[model samples]
Target: MKFVGPLIALMLAATPLRAEIDITEVTSPDGINAWLVEEQSIPFVALELRFKGGASLDLPGKRGATNLMVGLLEEGAGDLDARAFAEKAESLAASFDFDVGDDAVSISARFLTENKDEALALLRDAITQPRFDQAAIERVKAQIVSVIRSDAQDPDTIVGAEFDRMLFGDHPYGSAIEGSEDSVAALTQEDLVEAYKGALARDRVYVGAAGDISAEELAALLDKLLSDLPETGTPQPADIEVTTDAGVTVVPFDVPQSVAIFGHEGIARDDPDFFAAYVLNEILGGGGFEARLMEEVREKRGLTYGVYSYLVPKDQAALYLGRVSSANNRIAEAIEVIRDEWTKMAENGVTQDELDSAKTYLTGAYPLRFDGNGPIANILVGMQMDDLPIDYVNTRNAQVEAITLDDIKRVAARVLKPEALRFVVVGQPEGLES
Candidate 1:
């Protein structure tokens, strides 16, 4: 035990560290803005672009249109069909990925310095002039429908869906990112085009670039890439309260083990006590083997293989959530233990030793995240999305270090409400009932 810290320090020091990132805010000639980190070490560049509204822009009945549109972005564009577009990208050794989540549609592009111009042009065409061909649209729609059908039969998926419905009611946040089969099947080519425009407009865009590029060069590239997008998007989703009352919601499935998802309302990313709460969460459940939940639920009583909790701060609402799985007869006991730990954490707080260990691990593990261009660019964009300061990377460790036992106690009392926890259990647990 005495040698643990020193061994960890040595291992961390042995790993190569990237140089301090100097991020530059660049404004394109067309008034579009992006964050740029100029790293000349590599002969390639990675760009991450995000449109803020994402699938939330889907109108009342068009829940899955944004997801389908994003999938078709790279399928075919301009004069290139699907096969030709893929072949062109392969010849230049450029890679483009487009994905849609609840809050954003993300485009990640990697290209060699020599082929940057051609690569950017191809990407621009994909984004601005996607054909939305009939064949490609049907093909992608079938694929999405297949996934939705498969999820309907999954226990975890059912629990998550029911949990969201309980929390948000009829809000867009309650719906699946890939809309249900009925909603998706009714969508048409016109709906895809409309969602495409509404979801990827310039007003909601955020950009980050890293690798062999200069701020001036990135500025021009940003314009060429984003200038053609619509100037504004549809209205953003309004913030809604997470309205889940405290209770057990049992969704019966005939499985040998029961899966449970439990949580209550959470703090936002920019909340003043977020760091303290972060450390407190680490002590409660986020610390793997070192966490109270894992120690008490998995190691002490052997209730389940693992247990964990985390902060889910979304754009509209927040949640403090955790998950565990156990034998049908033992799942109820595991939940009771979890609640006991939750209550204890809020009332008694963590010990000084727990605080110290959490800080050490968090601060030590942070610097290892910036090992490459893609990761750095992604981190920069994420920081911006979270409304962090430009120098957040340098100050993050200090923030962790500043958290005290008293700080954890205060944040724990404010953020954790043991009595408010709601559990959504799936499967026939012998000792539990809704």
Candidate 2:
């Protein structure tokens, strides 16, 4: 009788569950916009800062300058040399990294709250007064060259290099963010310094913080971090054109397993049909297990261990890709099956069951992305970068659920074009249809 009373109270208390997120939008005294989310559940904090004019802003003949610039930021800052910098970070039990992407450069840090001062100081020094030391420059160049040389021998890397070269054409996005061996060898310390001077500006910066940070303190930290930055810089925008090139391009490799990457141009992040495209993608290939590509290419035919497809919605242009691997003999068959599925989905539209399952997966699995501060921080930053409304994470599943069969058909037709697809295979494949 007493057990029954306790169970009833437990059930009643659980009914009023709610989600709490203490989000504070802080504009630094110096005018940098930052988002601070204070989470007391964990004794950790993370800082993410982004600057505009990323790799796309690299000048002609300096295709990889932005990447090189950010690379040196952590190598030496103020008086700390590379080894000292690394040791200090290690001693503080902090994780710090910086990367340059198509449209921005980002620096992120994660550390325990006890070591907050050290981590923040390091980040501030790295951002404000990066040494760009000549010795460090040379060392980083050598490392980049080593990576370029090694990656040249990898089939997947070769395919990517070719794809980017073919897709973006003369644009900066077409080029590898990491410069070639020749480019890296030609890069001087001055190049990195100039890139840093031009790209890292206070007005173009945005910061996101989560896990144990108040709004006022976060803003003060950001002001110190970017105190040396200029007020503004030239905003470089990327204009990517969709190329219609459908043909088989083989990169000769002696590897036993062939890697196949096939795709065409896709919708950008701001497209109105973006949600529809996302849901259609899941039914077609993005669902992993119940996807058509997996069913046809893996489970049914046993052609490969894994096969999947999705639209990689990016800042400028999106890319739709279906990737799989199989023995050299099975590559052609896999591509054929993928193309056939594409054509069928476009022409006949997806079945009601496929549509229902995709909606269910997208809706039911939505809550998993909100489990932690880290994921929320990432999603928040991405939305900010893409110029999306702050309600994106909240309204995303409703958007997905609203997609009808006609919406799927319309998006599928626009998103998939077999004749425009560029076929890339890294090894010899059987059934040699192409």
Candidate 3:
């Protein structure tokens, strides 16, 4: 008998990881659109609900209310107090959570199939009829105010906040989604109520479900979740524009290290050259270890511990950002290096090897995004929120694979502008009088 037979057979029979995902477009009977995929391997289920207008639609003078409202959702609902809610969830071995971001708000739940109905009922109550108890409301508001107070003491936080204020000016996007100290201090229960009023609109909600449930059952659950929601006025999208005046804007803060955040606007998600733009960034700073910014700024000169650039995309506007940290004395040199790299990339684009490697990296990582039901459900919700094509999940890798060196050069030329750089330094630069 050959004792090694079982191990060899196992090795030979193993399946290689798949990079292509089959995401099916699904619609609820009540007219809500979603993307659903079934996985029964685990005896668990997950539901994620995303709404279009996130913190962006926070009513004027009530900044941070959206975040506060979501935080308070699980504190109490229906007849359960915060403690009672927690006890019930623990007993059922389920999880319910909510989060707010710049462009959307999400409520999610995970539960064993054995306790699915109880979890669903609890989640429905939280979304449709949150109690917003006054005591818990004050407690959360105080916590937010304290965090805002503490953030003000940080030099990086100071620089970033001031940078947004300068870049966005009077736009709603410029304001902190979590809000300022004054705003958070002034927030009350009425403000939370009003925020929920706008946020829970039926038209504003999009639901995604993945697990051991049929499309029909999910549709019925979605209706029940949103039925009590008022048909309140929809959130009006803002008209955001980015303007960068080329000069170093200095905001002096007392710190040993200088924090620099550089750059202006970048291409939006829907831009025709979005793929090319992504590749251009990968060569410049998006690639973690092999990026030009890291090789030149950190590796060669030892000017900073970390220096990288990225694109932050939004519904109507997007921004390009680069950060570097060095002693106050070497701050100007770091800034010059960043600017020179920008000019160099703009004039002469990436090499073919670099371009190929970037494409391969993006394509290889694409399939890892669908490793589990939670990630798959999140992707489905994102595509629906952005009104992306149903086939986007399947076709995205092909799109990346098809990009060429010429495409990289074209997009780099358009996006990388040293002259348009909006340089912001938040600490005192040595040898320069303020």
TM-score of each: 0.95, 0.90, 0.92
Q: Which has the better lDDT: candidate 1, or candidate 3? A: 1
Give the number of colliding residue pairs in candidate 1.
0
CA displacement after TM-score superposition, residue 92 of candidate 2 (Å): 3.0
Best by TM-score: 1
lDDT of 3 by residue, 336-398 (tens): 788889989999998998988888898888887765566667777877776778788779888
Per-model clash counts, in order, read 0, 2, 0
lDDT (0-100) at residue 180 of candidate 2? Answer: 80
Which residue runs does candidate 1 get wrong by more than 4 Å?
Answer: 1-16
Clashing pairs in 1: none
What residue pairs clash in candidate 2, if any at all?
328-429, 329-430
- Model 2's lDDT to the true fold? 0.78
lDDT of 2 by residue, 1-434 (tens): 33533432342233221144445778879777877667765666767778866888887888678888888988989899888998888777777889988788888777667788888898788888899888888888888788888988888887777777778887887778887878777877788777887788876776777776778777787777787787776567666776857777787789888887888888887889988888888988998779998999899999999988878776667789878889997888888888888888877778889999999988888776655555556656766777876666667777887889999888888888878877888876665534
Worst 10-residue lDDT window for candidate 3 reads 7-16
